[model samples]
Target: MVAPRKYPLELRERAVRMYRTSDPRPQIKRLAVDLGVHPEALRGWIRQAEADRGERDDRLATAEKEELAQLRREVKELRRANEILRTASAFFAGQLDPTRPR
Candidate 1:
């Protein structure tokens, strides 16, 4: 039986990088075959990475706080924009009202 890898992260990443380059398919296939893992698993890893490309944090408890922090920053920016818009709207409304004396 093969020794289970507690940390395949680095090696798996290298293998994925090799696969993406102009490296031959046979070489990639042979690497996976020698690793005793299905080729599709490598593809799945790459796909998952691509899917999470833009997502800074994942759906984990620790990441949740990071996500919340990011969301709070975004909300603060939005609130500022809304306040600016409201100010502009009020100024325009006051200027446009015909019944109010200039």
Candidate 2:
């Protein structure tokens, strides 16, 4: 399960908007200090926003990240199911073996 965000969505959006709309781009540290948020957090948000906007290529956009996470979860579940099926097949095969005593 994912942990709750330290800052609200509204604040994140507002901060990103503020940074993007400013004529002179603000320093991340300074903006974070003014907003009472961690500089790294703000930087990540900016990077993600840029990715979403197609302005950056280093990181996946929000939708892509979500889809990746979902795919990972599905792969995990399928692997677990396959393991269970394999174990069950082995157990049935052992039970049906006639070479050993009943």
Candidate 3:
């Protein structure tokens, strides 16, 4: 069995671009044959990359929406707590200074 060779990322990106372009099938096949790799392998790489790009975009949008929701809840709770504290402070102040109250 032949040992599999490691390919660089730039090479893979180039291969994917070539596979995705409007080149004729025969030309693509000849390029793959010259590179000693299957034409289908390059085509599959392009397809998988496209799928992954869309999936990543969707996940990023979902995460941002979740984070925004959590932040809004936090702001609401904090405002409620602050209002309660202010009300209590006013009540105590009135009770302590009723003699010369303004």
User: What TM-score would each prediction reach against the true structure?
Assistant: 0.39, 0.90, 0.40
lDDT of each: 0.68, 0.94, 0.69
List candidate 1 stretches off by more than 4 Å. 1-60
Write one digit per residue (lDDT tens) for candidate 3, span 1-102.
547756666777777676667456446567677766777776555656665567444233534656988899999999999999999998988888969566
Over the stretch 48-90, how does candidate 2's per-residue lDDT look in tens digits? Answer: 9999999998899999999999999999999999999999998
Question: Candidate 2: RMSD over Cα atoms?
Answer: 1.7
Cα lDDT of model 1 overall?
A: 0.68
List candidate 2 segments past 4 Å from native.
100-102
lDDT of 1 by residue, 1-102 (tens): 558864377867776676666445545457677766677777665555544554334433444547988899999999999999999998899899989776
Off by over 4 Å in 3: 1-60
Best by lDDT: 2
Q: Is candidate 1 or candidate 2 better by lDDT?
A: 2
lDDT of 1 at 99: 92
Ranking by lDDT: 2, 3, 1
Best-performing candidate as measured by TM-score: 2
Task: Kindly give the number of clashing pairs for every candidate.
Answer: 0, 0, 0
